[model samples]
Target chain A: MTSIAVPPSAPEHTGSRLTRVLGAATAVSWVVWLTYGLVLSPADVVQSESVRLFYLHVPLALSAYLGFTVTLVGSILVLRKNSAFWDQMAGAGAEVGLVLAGLVLVTGALWGRPTWGTYWVWDPRITATTLLFLVYLGYLVVRRLDLDAEVRARRAAVFGIVAFINVPITRYSVQIWNSLHQEATLSLTDTEMDGSQLTSFALGAIAMALFTTWLIIHRFRVGWLEYELDRSGLESAILERRGERTATEVV
Target chain B: MIAAVAGDAARIVAKDLRIERATGVITTQILPFGIVMLLLFGFGVDPALQVRGGDRSVLAEVAPGLFWITVLLALLLVVGRAFAVESDDGSLDALLVAGVHPAAILGGKAVVVAAELVVLELVVGAGAVLMFDVTIGDPLHLVVVMVSTTVALAGAGTLFLAVVAGQRGRDTLGPLLVLPAMAPVLIGATAAAGDALYGAGSGGIAWTWALVAFALLYSVAGIVGAGALLEDV
Candidate 1:
């Protein structure tokens, strides 16, 4: 039988010094955002308390878009370079983006219940975002398919590019379709922000961006470890098979 | 280069059409499935139900959505079958080994799916008309929307079908991937077809343009991305 040596001081987690710093920064910004956004900023005249949700909702939406944008760039890089690192980055971007997009929908719905008098409407942005979420959901499913690593990455990269192109086209079509049917009764961007409100929003956006970056970096590391483990496992299995063959031959 | 690609694509399309002709799956199975879906929509919407605040029946008013949804569902089968044959016999791998450009494969498959969908749409459109008793307000608009939407659906569907070609549980995954990607097609086609059939003046021409844009966009994506997607399978 083949024996393997274990490292005495291997890191037990995906975290590193940069991630630790990012984690601390994200935590500090969130605390600051919570203090200012919840207490210091004034509410809207029309939307009143519901306007507070926009602090999280808008930033979350932006982060979601940014995450998917990372996926798009990573996917392009994968196709151009055919590197496993790029594939891992693409997958991490999509996983993080899908979570953020899901949160955006939930926050939007929770905010909508109070402001729009309905939990959901076929508003252009909302519809397009929902479809975008589903599109990435499909991407994730493709990523999970059982296949050879290179084949899987190639397939996923192509899908990521195609799905990213779909977002703007979806938004445009939904916009036109919405306009043809009825006038938009409420728009998400109609809020008028004062100085404190703007500061709070800006803070929240920065915090969310930092947090999203932290999550994606961690996720990418985790995916890299997983790929390494899979490769090592295959190597050991092959080694074990060779060892068994040698033992039987000696017998 | 373009000519070679076109030649390969033409040969593939011819081969697929020959297989389809021999099997009669589209006519015998898929076409009936679409018509039956139209019937099911009629039953589900209730034949006697009238539209709210309108003189038309509810089914008549919603016939466009139902019709497009049926076409979309049927398109799944068409696409699934298109690639299933290739994958089942390992012909996809053979083709790749034979050096058929992936773009040609994509183009050929998409064209065949679009052709099948057009035939399905015509039969299903007739079914909707007979079952719902709706009048065609603009034949030209209807034809344009149908053609463009069919092409868009085919392009997106073929690309996604390629994505899921040899994967497990692809039967379900195929729709999961294709439907959301093709949502814009459903919306644009439904709105445009409604205008064509009911003269609702709901920017049918503009919606037609949207469908055309979708068609062109996916066609380009499929042609460009298929090579990467189908590299090994």
Candidate 2:
């Protein structure tokens, strides 16, 4: 159990309160969603049982994007304000985003295998999504660099900003190149969703967003504690050496 | 301010050029490595087989993609060599403390690498044309695509190299970070160059414009973001 030292400037109440609230809320939401998704929702006319995968796949994809967006925001804050809060947020958001993005890839492939008759396709959407995943994986690599804390934070922040800026470019270029996937089934302009499907989807997305937030907060605290622990260890080691020298002199 | 930056950048470029010239790494190392890559690809593909298979010219069709792929691979070596020159004997520290803006350092480095890439492009492009039998129907368009792609690659390559500079295994990590990001550049440049070489108006001209956008985006981002990165040290 690593303990976080609350700095004078930090908020007194941060990790535990929010963590418990979010954890409970996410659990409840997941239960509601599972009931709605599995037991209540009607099967699709064409795809039947496989369509339920949609609830998981789409919300996970959206949550991954949300996670990265938070990273982008935190990265901007890090550069603008030189805030450690933002740095922790960016690092944690990136880790969470990377995991969710990976899950999106896995779930997407599983969904595709059943629906599209193959596990992988070079559809433009798939290509862009994979590129997004790779870009953030690179972000994680940057974060893992063995450097001073400040230097690492600054470098990762800049990388995060640059990577986020490239997302639209990647999406546009892939679209221009070509797409083989079926036309988008969900959108504001072209598609309409009925009551139960919309309700279930909204519930799932909310749960996912809450879950992402909860994980980021806990991870940020862990990072802060790690830094504090390292500094205290260094301080105590120096104190021990000084004490040893003083006792030798007394002798 | 701009003039001061330009002057400082010019000095850095001159210093780098002098060092590289003395070493002849550009001529002796990167150039040969690029040429060998071309030869290996040519021999492995064996355009002769395509010709026998009744294709008009498989090498010609593949020429643009092969050219960019070769350039992309050679780019990794060029970036590695450039940073290797900087990371020796506290030179990087000296530059950081020189009171010059970090963007100038970035500009200088990008110019140096971009110039090297141009030279590499000329030599390797000539080699590719000869062996791959690539015909340029529109040299002007080809030049545009090449220039834009070069700019994009230089900007992004320099930025990423700087980002990974402090890492231990940066030699390997730099390429891992850069290659995927360069995918759009690769796709757009290859497509536009294909149209230029083959005279195929297969809507690839649009990709050339995308290349231009990519170049500007990368260069501007590198310029704006590099100062903070350099300050991190």
DockQ of each: 0.77, 0.66
Candidate 2 local lDDT, residue A142: 91
Q: Which stretches of candidate 2 lie over 4 Å from their true place?
A: A1-15, A169-174, A192-200, A238-251, B46-49, B52-56, B199-203
Kindly report which residue stretches of model 1 are placed more than 4 angstroms away from their true locations once superposed.
Answer: A1-10, A169-192, A239-251, B51-55
Each candidate's fnat, listed in order, reads 0.80, 0.57
lDDT of 1 by residue, A190-243 (tens): 644558778888899899999999999999988887787677767778878898
lDDT of 2 by residue, A131-161 (tens): 8888888888998899887788888888898
Chain A (candidate 2) TM-score to true chain A: 0.85
lDDT for each residue of candidate 2 in B1-233, tens digit (9 for 90 to 100):
98998899899899889989999999999899889988887788865564645434777688788888888888888887777777756677678887878888888888899999999999999998887777788999999999999999988898988898756899888877888778778877888998898767766789889889888988887888877788755
Cα lDDT for residue A131, model 1? 88
* Per-residue lDDT over B1-233 for candidate 1, one digit per residue giving the tens place of the 0 to 100 score: 88888899999999999999999999899999998897787667744574555667888888999999999999899999999889998999999899899999999999999999989988888888887878898899888898889889999999998998887799999988998888878978998999998888877778899899888988998999988888887
Q: For model 2, state the Cα shift of residue A81 in Å.
A: 2.0
| TM-score of each model, in listed order | 0.91, 0.90
